[model samples]
Target: MCVVGIMVGLLLLFAAPGVGSLSLGFLFLLGAWFCLWFFPHDLAHHVVGRVLGVGFRYYFLGRSAITN
Candidate 1:
């Protein structure tokens, strides 16, 4: 998933500048931003935390307890 996201992001980054329409290029840039943030960013955080012996816990935020 991460690899796919990155690939898509790279494609968008490259494709944006060459687009003939300004609105289309802007949309591509927004897509690239979302892809970059939504995929590899979280994976990277988890990887680093593991390497440093940090533990993580997930919890719900709606009328429930949250943990770290």
Candidate 2:
């Protein structure tokens, strides 16, 4: 789903023309990158943590999670 959204955005970005389209594509790409790269870790920290009964004290740059 996420990949699909990014692909569609890229297609529109290239198919359309103008500064506005470029900016939209750039922002979409940036957001997609973040979602694919960062969102999963953060999501796991919250979901898996609680599910496994592990308590997270905090997160470090999304690369790691500190637990209690």
Candidate 3:
């Protein structure tokens, strides 16, 4: 997911010749790219699971895993 986000960011930058000159905008774009990408990454798991007819008892990450 991180790799995908980074690749998209870099590609957008290089693809537009003058894009790198806008420093603040570039940073904001990267931030938004990662945030938006995360949603579909999590959703992909659920969609694929149902399509394959496999069930996950539960899923956890970060601090949630400790309590779970």
The model with the greatest TM-score is 1
- Candidate 1 root-mean-square deviation in Å: 4.1
Per-model root-mean-square deviation over C-alphas: 4.1, 7.6, 6.6
| Model 3, residue 59: C-alpha shift (Å) | 1.8
lDDT of each: 0.86, 0.59, 0.64
Instruction: Return the TM-score for candidate 1, rounded to 2 decimals.
Output: 0.69
User: lDDT tens digits, residues 1-68, model 2?
Assistant: 44555466565445445435667767766665655564455565587779999977865553336577
Q: Once superposed on the true structure, which residue ranges of model 3 sit more than 4 Å away at CA?
A: 1-21, 63-68
* Positional deviation of residue 33's Cα in model 3 after best superposition, in angstroms: 2.1
**Candidate 1 residue-wise lDDT, 8-67, digit = tens:** 998998999999999999999999999987779767977899999999888233543657
Collision pairs in model 2:
none
Order of candidates by lDDT, top first?
1, 3, 2
lDDT of 3 by residue, 1-68 (tens): 54566567566545544554677666766665665566567677788889999988977676543453
Question: TM-score of every model?
Answer: 0.69, 0.38, 0.48
User: What lDDT is reached at residue 20 by model 2?
Assistant: 57
1 against 2, candidate with superior TM-score: 1
